[model samples]
Target chain A: MEDQKPTSILVLDDEPIVCKRLKSALEKRGYEVEIFFRSSDAFKRITERNFDIVITDLKMEGLDGMAFLTEVKKRSPATEVIVITGFATMETAKESFQKGVFDFLAKPFKLGEIQDAVERAEKKIKGNIS
Target chain B: MRILVALDTNRYSQYVVNEVAKLAMNTWADVTLLGVESRKPASNGTQPPRNLPIVRKLQEFREEFLGYFKDESVSPYAIKRWGYELVDRGKGLLEEMCVCKGMKDFRVRIRFGQPTKQILTEAVEEQSDLIVVGCSKGEQCTWEQDRNAPEKIVKAAPCSVLVVKEEKKPTKIVCCLDHDSVSQESLELINQMVTLHQTDLALVGLTESEHLREEVDQKMKQILQYYTAQKIKAWVSVVDVSLLDKFIADTAEKGLIALWMGHKSLIGKFFSQDRVGKLVRSAQSSVLILR
Candidate 1:
């Protein structure tokens, strides 16, 4: 507690309920969480500060999630971003990799799956794995 | 939920922080401590000059400071230096309040600009679920005559805003429901906060006259039925417009006031935004406005 740095997560999804449920779940697991239902707001946040991990949904109204991934990687290359979407395709997944996504999870995925991806990202942050 | 707790230099500011810590402990919510640094000089001009230390330090380490940044562009280095100092000062203040045991894993954000604008931008950036702004009882008189920044932020906030008026151990939450605008989504939120606070939930419906009593009655009954089935012990009441102030005051003595966000017209003909604003200002207890 005295020396360890806190890991913070930012979740961006158009669905308010998705942000809400994910936030509560992550917080309960001893992770700091922030949620944005809009990409524009998320972009502002990314400019102001950096988060340890970012979980974003691909399909959105304005400033699509794929564009967000690009912007985030450009701003902070080391920051890990995971893509989650209902409509997943090889093309989108390949593009996400090209933009530097840590992991890609499909929509209707379980909280357990997110936690697993986050754990892997945490290991990467700790320099335990690449 | 990701919650942002904004602090000021007010006497009661720490109380707000402590109360929020207690809330996080119960609900498993992480908090972001935000402090705004205004360029304006202190009103009383009693404190020591702020530029002394940084300027004096720069003089002593002029060679080292210049050497470190010698390779960087002159323009960007100067901007980073100033921004770093300001942000560092803001972090010092926020860190003082993060001493609580529950705040061990908190995040600090320091913004140098207008308080409302900074807060709104941070809230939007964080996509925060709640923004908890603290106000003292003594400052109410001054803010009542004019719409304060907190009031303005509440109106335009993209998420729910909780205005904690003073230090009060809330025993119940008086949820003011607009019969015309009540929806399942809002009710679900009301349920979450009520559960988070571990406080009793009471629904109060405002009506102007008996002409629409039957309609109001049916709506109240439906709300009660839904909440009851959810296993939440809830109560409902119908009150006239004239008695709203008294009802609010009575509730404030031992509980918080919960209201939903909606267009002013959707709040039934009897209630108005002005009255809601007044309720937030004058309430002795904290007010949680759900969006």
Candidate 2:
């Protein structure tokens, strides 16, 4: 029998404060969390390994969130992606869902919102495995 | 940021609370839920009874407020250890209820007196950045207890005031200001509004003359750059100060209208105090008076 591995999460936001806060909050919840301030850098890392969950901001300097999430889904269909944005619009939300995003959150969201979203995503992953 | 929420025993207050909750969730603002229990002429200077109906209503408001953050797993503010301690202050017995989760300050204060005066006093004492209050929908925004409470608060509050006409979300936000002196906090508040409603933003610049129009254009550009960088669906347009009133009247019917009425604001100079109050009363949509 093998010991269960902890869930892995990757967080990307251009704002360092957002990344830093989410990193600290998510890590305290006993998950393996990695953060990136640049979507391009996050893209590079995602290419290197697959993560169970990816949390991203929709608007960024390069490789915008939509494109990144599209790639994530293409590479690993089972991975859950949550989209957080300061600029939330109906079209973007519809598009994100169309890209198979697991959840969408607006900026200034309470830490609890992201926590709840991740927990739900975790349950789905576990359910699929079992 | 400090937000003073004026709640009464009405469904409108719930709309106000829900709106504020959406904002506070994002900003982590120090939130003060204020309820005023109007005193009878005979009971002017006495301690309010513990079982006053307003006290019970305030408790319900507190619970409805905290309910928005119940799913919050990161802070102790989410804990259900709610307690409020009332204190006497000679002039008006104020019940100060403290609910803390480390850094955030979420408290309830029950004031005794006129609703408008109590809300204004609390805004001054707390030095609140914004006051959130709701009014019934119609050509005249009314409160159940006081017919003119919302109008009075919007007119007299020392800080910014948000008059929520109803709980309905606006399709867009029209932010009107003449200069770039808009504070970062105001911009952040607009950001929170846009996010909560998932709406578009329209920046309207006001100018009186051709020379000032150029400056207004520059300022609008700077503001637009800020919102565009944030990735908000925002656009800009210039409106003459002469036509500002008409612009506001027309736009208010379409979406939420925010006016920068800070001391440095030229828009503040253009809109008289009564006009500001009237606008809040007559506007078909919610209004945010940014100070």
Best by DockQ: 2
| Weakest lDDT window of 10 consecutive positions for candidate 1 chain A | A85-94
The stretch of ten residues in a row with the least summed lDDT in candidate 2 chain B is B73-82
**Each candidate's interface RMSD, rounded to one decimal?**
15.0, 8.5
Clashes of each: 0, 1
lDDT of 1 by residue, B44-144 (tens): 44453345332233233333322333433221122221111222334345222222222112465556667788889998887666788876553362321
Q: Model 1 segments beyond 4 Å from truth?
A: A1-130, B40-105, B138-147, B182-189, B211-222, B263-271
Residue-wise C-alpha lDDT for candidate 2, range B1-291, written one tens digit per residue: 568999887778878888888776655556899888787434345555667776788888888878876645433244434456565655665768664343346888888787888889998877777899987766675575677788888767766789887777788899887655666557767887787677899998776763455566787788888877776779777788878768877887768999876643244455556667777777766889876
Model 1 residue B100 distance off true place after TM-score fit, in angstroms: 19
DockQ of each: 0.04, 0.08
Cα lDDT, all candidates: 0.66, 0.77
lDDT of 1 by residue, A18-72 (tens): 7998899899888889999999999999999998899998877789999999998
